[model samples]
Target: MKMVLFLTVSFIIIGFVVVVSMKGKMERKLAFIQENADNHKNATTPIILWIVGTTFWGLVSMALIIGMFFMN
Candidate 1:
């Protein structure tokens, strides 16, 4: 139980750090897309994938943390 708690907390922290760190890069990508108006094929795939992945993991971590508290 302790290990599970630790892992979930670590995941949440790591995910937060990753999203914050990637903010600048994501912005740059957006800016590039904005400037290049003609090339619109899969221009936002990276940003979409990153957001979906992070959001999914973050929700899973939160669910685990909440479950542990209620189950115990």
Candidate 2:
């Protein structure tokens, strides 16, 4: 039950971060699109930020799980 709760909270935090980041990215993209209506170029998402964020979260979560397992 403790592990379950930990996983649930970890996922919830990660999910919230993903949602908030995506929302901010989308908003910026929309603003760029609106500003450059003539170009019609595709607004690109920041792949690097997403990659780094995911990697950081994955590492942290794995470390937490491993630590918990060892403690138990």
Candidate 3:
């Protein structure tokens, strides 16, 4: 529970930092996405997309670890 909470907090902090740092620049990025949504359908093409994917995978892995604690 502690580790999971810690990780959740850490990711929230890190995600905050990423968004804070990219606030203004995100509009351009969104525009790019809108313009190239189909052209860049491949996941690896964008760093933000990769970050999002990794974040999601990390959360899933964390959830699995927590689930193990409940299983046995």
Model 2: how large is the Cα RMSD against the reference?
A: 5.8
Model 3 clash pairs are none
**Which digits, one per residue and each the tens of the lDDT, describe model 2 over residues 22-68?**
87776777787788977855444454466577677777777766766
Where model 1 places Cα greater than 4 Å from the true spot, the runs are none
Question: Is candidate 1 or 2 superior in lDDT?
Answer: 1
lDDT tens digits, residue span 1-72, model 1: 788788878888988898899989999998999899588768899989988988898789879888888968
lDDT of 3: 0.66
Q: Give the TM-score of candidate 1.
A: 0.83
lDDT of each: 0.86, 0.69, 0.66
The alpha-carbon RMSD values of the candidates against the true structure, listed in the order shown, are: 1.4, 5.8, 5.5
TM-scores of all models? 0.83, 0.45, 0.38
lDDT digits (tens) for residues 19-64 of candidate 3? 5676566566667778888876553256576468657856866776
Query: Which one wins by TM-score: 1 or 2?
Result: 1
What are the runs in model 3 whose C-alpha is more than 4 Å off? 1-45
A best-first ranking of the candidates according to their lDDT comes to 1, 2, 3
